[model samples]
Target: MCDRMPLLGMFPSQKRSPPLTIMNLTKLHPFLLLGSFCLASLATCDTAKANDVVGPLVGAVESTSANFLYRVGESEQPLRLSVLLDGDVVQAVDSIGRQEDDFVAKFSISNLRPDTRYHYQITNTKTGETLIEADEQHAFRTANPARHGNRVSVGFVSCVDIEPNGIWKEMQGLDLDTVCLMGDTPYIDSTDLKKVRTRHREFLQMPDLAELAANTPVVGTWDDHDFGLNNGNGHNLMEGKVDTRRGFVNYRAHSQFGNGKEGVYHRVDLGMIEVFFLDPRYFSQTEPSPVDPTQPTCFGAEQWEWLLTGLRESKAPFKVLAFGAIWEDKKNFETDDMFTYWYERDALLDVVKNENIGGVVLLGGDIHVARHLIHPQRVGYDLHDFVISPGHKRTITELDVFHPSLEWSLVEGWQFLTLTADGTQAEPTLTAEFRQPDGVVNRQVKLPLASLTAVDSSKPDSGLRAHWSFDGDLKNQSVLGDRVDAVAVNDALVVTDGGVSGGALKLDRSREQFARVPRSFLDDNSNHHTVSLWFKPTSLPAHGTSERHFLLESTAEGTESAKSAWHLSLGMRSSEDASKVNLQLFTHTLQPATEIGAAPAAKAQGGFDALVDREALLGRWNHVVLAFDSSSLTLTLNDKQIAKHPLPVPGPASEFGGLIIGGHRVGAGRNFDGWIDEVSIWQGEMPAETK
Candidate 1:
């Protein structure tokens, strides 16, 4: 219902209040006032009370298994707990004593069946009084197994300053197996351990949140607001320079932080997906010298090593790296993010690239908005980071600035994300859906597992018409046996190291170089064909130049004015807009000369042009596929369709010249300065297997 409400309505235009302080509470509407009142009243209860149970039974779930860790509030009387599966009491405990000051009781239940649902209840054993009756049964489902080919859905959100009553209702109805609170779950922002604990109790006392937590397993880490101050890091100063790191670990369910460190960083493995809960606030030092390897880093040495080891060791089909803040550097904001420690961040990505680790995705929170960003050409693939925040709080309108790497962003209403991993096919697929409080899906994207994996050209497929691996030679290794030797135009076109495959042909910008074949492999006018290749641009055209850098082209032998038969070129629209380059595919024929001396012009040219907007990072290999059928032409980048356009007319069938690589013509100015490898031409639409 608040989807249409103005973003400013969520946060009044006034001076901010400190965390745990209720100066802004009186400004909230009646509904929020009632909710806050109930939470405060429950959280303020005395811990030594005999029958009064504060912060009743709460469960922290395992990442990828059917295990649960249950925690409860202070209770003097001995308590009895029971867990039921399919209406049968499968596990039970009695006379469990509460811990020290908080008198909280902790229990761990393990070895349950995967994907199975269970109900739990608690009672006082001394007086046979049911503190939590079976009627209010809390139900939860275990994580799904990877081998079962089932879909595992996990929901995530952050920045729940003031509980939105409807948000939890929406989450409860989603029936997610696991819910990850990325950060700012409760705005404690206090160095006092007692105050922090009380704030967590207040958060748990919310009716909707409590109901959702009871029925669904919850996992989380903390951000600045919950870790003591706004934008606070490991060096944050409280009373007497005391950091709130201890308070964060004490109140949360995380049993371990890295190797004796107090930070709350951990990893959870759910059947096919592994989620890495990162702590960037705690253990992070201020920006150090970029070149100083011994300087303090964002993730200390131990945690960083653990993360690398886990990533290298994980065999899961997907890895979700969850953070409490934005991953990339935002131009407008002066905040603590991965950008501040670019060296360490790049080093982490280098491990993935060098180790050839696949199926990695980033998740973030604390921006108070939801958006999808792509770190262009990180390692071998384009790394995607999804940021979701302000679970039920007000969204920020001014934060909606245009980011070149941003794919989709929402600055208005509150939203949550549901990522579902499906391992039913040959390759696992992950689908992320962002939905509103009313259960309406705002955006959805399905990413294939192959996107994160290395380019494996070893697979055999029957649909492959032509494949130029370019390992050591320009031989076509397709079933058709259409082999063509490379005719190098200049010395600059030579085999070089650093390829997705083996050796790739390198083209220099300062020199004129290209390779051509003797026969026309793509001369067929069937209107169903695919051309796929790997390319890495060394440099973009100068700012005010309409220079056309041809990666591949085919033309008939004629005079200098003769039109190109067909070409795939990277060029700017005009001199004024040279920054916006376009990768265009032109298909047509040269008009027949009226007389022997007359020059030939273009007959009928109609193809597609896709803007090389984001994924075109310099010095990184990029996979591109230009596929067309009888109806439309689709341009795929890194295994995802980036652009598609319907053909206005059927492609013209002309006697084409040989295939040209790295230049427009043999002696033309349109020369490419990059590396090209793994060139393939298919007679029909490119199959998923080929990609």
Candidate 2:
């Protein structure tokens, strides 16, 4: 057993021999053709002498069980597998024939000793000829059942087209417990079943990788490129979705494919470390909102719940959340990773934070760069995303953009990460090392499990609950670091200079622009609160028009005015006297079960609202405040108290949604065309000045 954790026994970079000359090195970063890997493997196997077999490829090896896969030509002798323990036969499983399905056979064996090394040989049961003709004997070891005894590690590889790809050889010697082919492992951008399956096999069966996979377990989920298209999503993204998924499943063996239903998201437990491999492409839906908030899904609903429930129930000391897409906010709702699926992303982090799931480290690929991104105060701890991409050299297109949370990045490509988990120590830690093919370490991070589980981001704090001084980034700045940062929907929000402070978020009415707030800040018990902000509206409709401009809203699209949980806007009063900018506060006091309800008469309405108007409140920077003290709600404009009304409800209201700023979520006509700066919120009461 490997007892040394990365942190406890830090090994400095080793001396390397002279660099192997790579072909076609260029100034714009070199490209390694896909032929390199296949050609290298073919040369080693000698095509004419490879027998009738493609593999004795091994997979899904656990503490007591193992699975094997292979594709062979016309051969009658059914293969038999022998598990050799020190030259003595310990256990064996005979291959089942299914020649019609492309000469494929599978072998499954159980009751193997844990943490013990054993050699394996596939032989013709009738002919008595050993099928494995490799130069070296093939072998594998089982996982340790002792959950916290030895250190466990997995190396991540993706976008695997680098030539002179010595990284495979580097990993060949590590004897890692598992290997995660993060995504784009085979680069199949077509839905053709044959191409998809063949590419996967070639990558997995590459000579340098073949021996390693036979010894160490290989697990994977797919990204866009390997998922059969670039930026593909939804249920019908692929022509034959079933076959595309089967191509992955048939070529590589995972403990379970998805939840035994749809998708490929699965959990792999390695000693004290458990990795949740997410299938971002399979179940993703296109949610174009101010949405039907509940309609948009990335993990779909099933996988979303499965992930949350699993995280909530997981007992592993180190839990790794693996995504085929990067965690950075790219704002390209149609194609980018987590940012487009902000709801699920935030929801997952919220669960990890609220439930105190410690030792949660995030992993990502599909962006051809090696990076360590630090998200400050994420779930009570500074969350870090370790990203590795381009198994060799450069990629077709490197996903580039400096996220606000970037700690460091090295784009020399040729990158992979060694994710090691050590739970034997008092403070178990998950260490991630982003390294290159040349044995150079770009960055390494070792975070303690205790640090991750300690903070309570949702455990209510006094005073300022939220503050957003755009200030070049969108992170929530408050005394309490709840990790509830704002999300810019549809690339609609951007921070610009010359605000009330350093910078302010700019939104245009011509585009779909708004910042989505987390649900926690607008919970049911948040009636007693103060909200203040500075804004300058650059665009507005004529006074007599029926168009209402929403500045802050929680209403779902295609819902009735009375159905919205809350809507704060600037609208007309009556055409005859609609001469000024009227600030309207609308909210529903709902039945406990529902957020939407039937219209109620003015006085019969349950929650408090007001129509406070000011003639000179447009085209210039102005300060506005909305203060509610449970009993009453007050509206103030430019340091002047405009209106104070008793708390009542117009209709049913449920805290079932999130807040959006600088526009109504549904359309551009109702969006606030403005610059909003220094938005702040206090949970307990109104600010002293307002009172």
* Winner by lDDT: 2
Writing each residue's lDDT as its tens digit, candidate 2 over 627-647 gives 765455678878888788765
Model 1 TM-score, all chains together: 0.59
Off by over 4 Å in 2: 1-53, 74-77, 133-137, 162-164, 259-262, 286-294, 331-336, 395-398, 457-691
Q: Report lDDT per candidate.
A: 0.63, 0.63
Candidate 1 lDDT over 631-664, as tens digits, reads: 5667877777878876555432343545677777
Question: How does residue 118 of candidate 2 score in lDDT?
Answer: 80
lDDT of 2 at 593: 13
RMSD of 1: 17.4
TM-score, predicted candidate 2 vs. hidden true structure: 0.64
Model 1 regions lying over 4 Å from their true place: 1-58, 63-75, 86-88, 93-101, 134-136, 238-243, 258-261, 286-294, 425-427, 456-691
